[model samples]
Target: MLTPTVVSNSTVRRSSRTPAANARTSTRCSNCAMRHLCMPQGLTVDELPKLEALICNARSVRRGDFVYRAGDPFENLFVARSGSLKTVMAHRDGREQVTALRLAGDPLGLDGISTGMHTASAVALEDSSVCIIPYPALKHMCRETGAMQDRLHRLMSEQIIRESSQMMVLGSLSADERVAAFLLDVSERNGQRGYSHAEFNLRMTREDMGSYLGMTLETVSRTLSRFQKRGLIDAQGKLIRIIDLESLRRL
Candidate 1:
């Protein structure tokens, strides 16, 4: 019942103030830049159109907008078609935690699958766009397509692995080690997306980083300064450059 705008590739660059119901596009999944990451593999030429037909819509989310709030109905799974997003969970006592950072090519809304409602809120980190895959339709397709079913299973398994790794980072790593691993993880993800892994802009603020890394804001700032002094990194405001990759890894 959620009625976001159906956008094509050309319709994605509208003003941030544009209402979601006002825009439209004809872009197809076959031509999407993120197909390599979001699409199932080994589909025949004839089968490609069926997937494209199901994924004809996308929605743009302006920075700081909530893509979907916690407790919202789980109607669609989203792939980050462009830009970044962060998933956050709110405590009953009013505290919030950054649960995960999602970049382009990453999937969102899986958290809702278990309960038929979202457990956390997804917010855009920048002016981002998401390709919407209606879950009921996708579930139906998966029932008929072996490749699609396999891809869905693999995506779910990868989410489990990521959650396990986050637990490991929080439970065992020191503050310095935690920060190092965070940077390395971001670098690797950027590399995977064909960007320069050695340097990239961090869209999140220091406080958000602290929330995600389980460090105090002061501690996060101090650690970054220490890394700069040690020649482990060069950070200018939001831009970060990993100067000593091997040394950072050794941490």
Candidate 2:
């Protein structure tokens, strides 16, 4: 399971942006790291310049900023350039359930496509920058370009696969198994984003973890303690070190 860390006040900072010196001119498009990820896989040089014009670099969000809330009109697809984000849904009874935790290089707000409104709230878990791809422009591109259509299909397919995995986790696994599976999943995703797979910081709280795993906060705590006692993981407050990855996988 992921452990929550109490970050010091000094680590938090507000999102800020300053005007670019060459704001009036179009910039070169070859250097963008998210080019292939945000757009189609095989965009031609002729198409890139137009795509660049539609994209705007935005300020980084601090750790508690809401990117967008549930019920907000969908405007853009946010591609995380750095740090992490948590997507949550709230119940009528006032309980919040964490739906997904996104890392750098993941796309946010895709769920808005079906309803034309955000289905969940997205909040930054750390200082993060997101490339805003306006939805109208993207829709136009997808209709006009075959490559964009293929990319959108691939993205939707990926979402389906993830949702299927989540259903299996929630419906079939025990509390301890769920926690173990979640940590391993997070570790693998973190590794994909160029961080250490087995060792990295966890930003979500125990309550949030419990919500995601469909368990009470106390059950979450008990499971973590049991894992620690069995030498599967070491927890010192929020800092957790995985000691038995194979055992965790077995659970």
Candidate 3:
């Protein structure tokens, strides 16, 4: 189970990578690269150790494997430690929609909080790894101090902001406008994670992108071709280079 069950000091607090059997390990929050973008961002140095004690290391998830499924019990929140994953929601008519794409350093499983069960399913888009944050342990930890409590609220606020942005994309944008915005958004987010903003590969398929943007796959293709003809972007297979970010934003 990815859900947290905080063991006593005699358990996970032992020296790491020991030769003994039954050894359990946790990552240090102070040393995490994503600490500033994650729930532990505001934790002080003194409080970092406490936060570290709450996270449990996890094994890698293979491509096409599911991290969790809709209707499953919500025990933990998942962080994309490496690679990427997609969240899917199934329609009553049996169609599935890709709700979101999660990259390294991104958080997942937040939608499970409302009903204590997951509302969407997460599948690894590539071989991936996740940090499992035990929800029970996290909630208990939040109650122990003020900083983490505020951090929890901030995390939720960010989620709300992301949801709002997604809503705007779906409700207001035209097909070409949607693709333009999607590329720019992904590029900006990728840059934040230390990748090249203007040049990168598209991890999501055209079909997935169309699903996210509420456009048909053919529409996505035509729009890209149009963007290419206009010199707004250069697409060679899955790789894309935005030649005119200003034009894209204007679109």
For this target, which candidate reaches the highest lDDT against the unseen true structure? 1
lDDT tens per residue, model 3, 143-230: 9878888877877898789879999989998888899989998899889888899998887889998888899999999999999999
Task: Give the per-residue lDDT of model 2 (tens digit) for 156-209.
Answer: 888789878999999999898899998999888766656677677788888888
Instruction: Please provide, for model 1 over 1-251, each residue's C-alpha lDDT reduced to its tens digit, 9 standing for 90 to 100.
Output: 33332232233234224565334564477777777887899988887888877763567788887778888777778889899989999989989999899999899999988999889988888889888777888999999889999999999998899989999999999999999999999999999888899999999889999999999999999999999999999999999999999999999
Clashes of each: 1, 0, 1
Q: Which one wins by lDDT: 1 or 2?
A: 1
RMSD of 2: 6.2
Q: If ranked by TM-score, best first, what sequence of candidates would result?
A: 1, 3, 2
Best by TM-score: 1
Q: Residue 111, candidate 1: how far off, in angstroms? A: 0.9
Candidate 3 clashing pairs? 4-134
* TM-scores vs. true structure, each candidate: 0.90, 0.83, 0.87
Residues forming the 10-long window of minimal summed lDDT in candidate 1: 4-13
What's the CA error at residue 218 for candidate 1, in Å? 0.8
Q: Candidate 3: count the clashes.
A: 1
* Of candidates 3 and 1, the better by TM-score: 1
Q: What is the lDDT of candidate 1?
A: 0.84
In angstroms, give how far residue 133 of model 1 lies from its true place: 0.6
